[model samples]
Target: MSFKYIDVIKELINKIENSQLDVMEKVAQLCAETIIRGNILYFFGTGHSHMISEEPFYRAGGFVPVYPILETSLMLHDGAYKSTLMERVNGLSKILLEQSGATKDDIIFIISNSGRNNVTVEMAIEAKEKGLKVIAITSLIHSKSVKSRHPSGKKLYEIADYVIDNCGVVGDAAVQYENFEQKTGPTSTIAGVLIVNSVISRAVEIILDKGWKPPIFMSSNTDEGDEFNKKILQKYKSRIKLL
Candidate 1:
């Protein structure tokens, strides 16, 4: 591999390691408090970043109160596939927020690699206006260096109340390891995993500090599925409504 790749990866680790723990603490506090207050946590992402949104759901030790605001409905899942031009012309952010039943007490986590897409930006705006605290996971270096496609020229960082910079390049590749001519995949996958783990760990701490057992889910594949399912459901009984 090239020295450029090595250097970038090292830099990313340093940035995250040196990050202010205050942000994670705040997020955990918000999440625990919101759930305790009977509000939901909404997560949204576009394209590849959608994987990040799925990381925390239905996993062992995962929260049950998260709403992934991706349109899984057959009619609006993909605008490009829509038969009607009007359906394709619609602003997806509004629909997502409306369907999720977002409110002032809800928290939103938005994952965007570029932090420049119209849908993600609009969701951040809508959530913010509705009094939601939005957390953004995106690449700072990439977003700053690249020209945004948002018409208002606003990027993800501009809209988020808390910004978590995922260490990666514009193409999310560190260097040309596989092909000596071009850069390959960078640390986005690593960043996504790290962010989710950190969120969960800190959330556990906050929950414990509040004298409550953390409401974490266990895999349905587990032998203790019934017990775990009961625990998770009881923990999140009134906060989450799954369709």
Candidate 2:
């Protein structure tokens, strides 16, 4: 039996490594600058894309000031189908951004596989209006194939200051079987997590090169991890909600 899903994922990862390295480096530089300026990093997404937003928050080896802009209505747990409708709502992005307490000069990563939804597109616009840098992680193939769902006729990639293609295909599912009507094994989550973690790791290196220690979280499973995490959490608890 062949593992077609794994093979497909490996191919996509290779594409990202070869095609997205330059853009990832630029994003890392922005992250390093934002952290050095005492600004936080915000992440936002809807539906399955929200997983990318939550991936680095409070995660081991993740940055301390990372904030995931989570809205119950936009998540799968509350109502997966409803979240799909909610992400199309025009004004919700502004409300979420305001509630996030994000300020100017911060950086926000907006993940949307399609990149055509109103919420993610508007979120990028709103972040730009607030003087925050917007970095979008989306599938160029998927996004370009569809028209914008935003009133401005702009997709997340069009609005963001930087765009990192997840190198995923349209509809995201990568594995298909003989006689199957629909594909299985989505690639966005895996590709997105890799893209995000790689950039964050590079940002840490950039910070170290600049002579500043990046506030990284240690695994709570390890000895001395709790104490280390507590000190780091205390520093950003006021700024990062859900910390």
Candidate 3:
């Protein structure tokens, strides 16, 4: 049998539709609370998974005060293979957290499709130790099937305060075809994006329920949009390094 591109889209949409609303709501509530308390929301991941962290950071129509704890050593552009190795090294999470100045009131989002890597797990553990709330976006099936690389023998999902499973398979490739033993289409990225956006939408909803006008970025293209975002930038530029 042959699998077409729409097949992958259908599979991904099904996964998203079936994703646990409770877990996603928990993540959103945490983010909304962080925003209410005027604290930062932090995101961290490694390699391809790091792209998930960048999805909401400093973007138009995105929430303000969201920071991505990006480390070049673990990012692909610098060295893909090197990033993989760096994610396995213990104690790196602490450095990243310290540099970010994450606090108990902050919300930290850690993304790892597989959830087995040492650094992602370690970062969640470290974040909790620092009194920060951690939300993990990972594959429950994948993490359960794989052994943890961390010394604690715990996966990212186990360490985070809120665990929102991407509901993907172990290897994350969803489409299969005859004569191809290994699947071709990887669905984790799109599924993850959907989950993250859902969480953000829910967070905004919760904030509005509380009668607070949450600070969200506006598009840079429009005149009012530019003015609105510029003020937000001027207010947070000192606190946010990337702003």
Candidate 4:
């Protein structure tokens, strides 16, 4: 019980280290192809899953072509309950997706740990309808355990062109203590981050192999880092909604 969280983290690492290489490489390949073709890569999620979309957007060592759809209504702020309600509201994603500038050559990633949310599912559907490729980051174990909230009775993984499982347990909590009903450690965030970064890094490596310089952001504190990132920032600020 004392080391349950540690055990949980170890399991998460093992999941990432083993059996995820094929999916990670495939995701990277798609991302690299998008970037090499000068197309955008968009990410979207609701609730806690939003953190994964936030991972690759204009951050240090991140790519400029990767954009995050940050719809305030679906985020946890001001009124979390309102955010929760909005996530289940149908047809909302269509309005957001229409303005995202995602094209047929681009890719859209929708994340939902349970793979059973109305917003994420609708976003993927809309993206696909627009001829964009859809990738999903979710826990298949969790999705299979629960019913999808979408009216179509389909999960995010079912709609996406690619699926990467976070391998997290249902409800996203993994730690169990003696005599306690609730689990403490929510492993989805950690697992999601790992999956996001690993895929992006692999994409970068693939780009490097081709001798084409990928626009990777550097920390602003360095002497020339600001100048280096400034060019990429200016180029993408107008294209990406939340730059």
- The best candidate by TM-score is 2
Taking the tens digit of each residue's C-alpha lDDT, what string does model 1 give over 1-243? 346756677777777767745676777777888766766778887666777887786667777777777654312346534422322223778777877778898899998878876777788888998999999988888888876565667888889999888867778887665447676656786787677678777787777888877666777887998686876686555545552
Q: Candidate order by TM-score, highest to lowest? A: 2, 4, 3, 1
Give me the displacement of residue 101 in model 2, in angstroms: 0.9
Structure candidate 1, residue pairs in collision: 172-186, 173-186, 175-183
Which pairs of residues collide in candidate 4?
Answer: none
**For model 4, how does the per-residue alpha-carbon lDDT over 58-125 read when each residue is reduced to its tens digit?**
78898898888889889998479999889899999999988887788899888889878888889988
Better of 1 and 2 by lDDT: 2
Question: All candidates: CA RMSD in angstroms?
Answer: 4.1, 0.9, 1.7, 1.3
* Predicted structure 4, TM vs. truth: 0.96
Question: What's the CA RMSD of model 4 in angstroms?
Answer: 1.3
lDDT of 4: 0.88
Q: What is the Cα-based lDDT of residue 94 in candidate 1?
A: 79
Candidate 3 C-alpha lDDT tens digits along 50-166: 888999987776789889999999998998899989989999998888988788888888999988888898899889999988888888988899899999998988888888888
Candidate 4 ranges beyond 4 A from true positions: 1-3
The clash count of every prediction, one per candidate, is 3, 0, 0, 0
- Global lDDT of model 1: 0.74
In candidate 3, how many Å is residue 174 off? 1.2
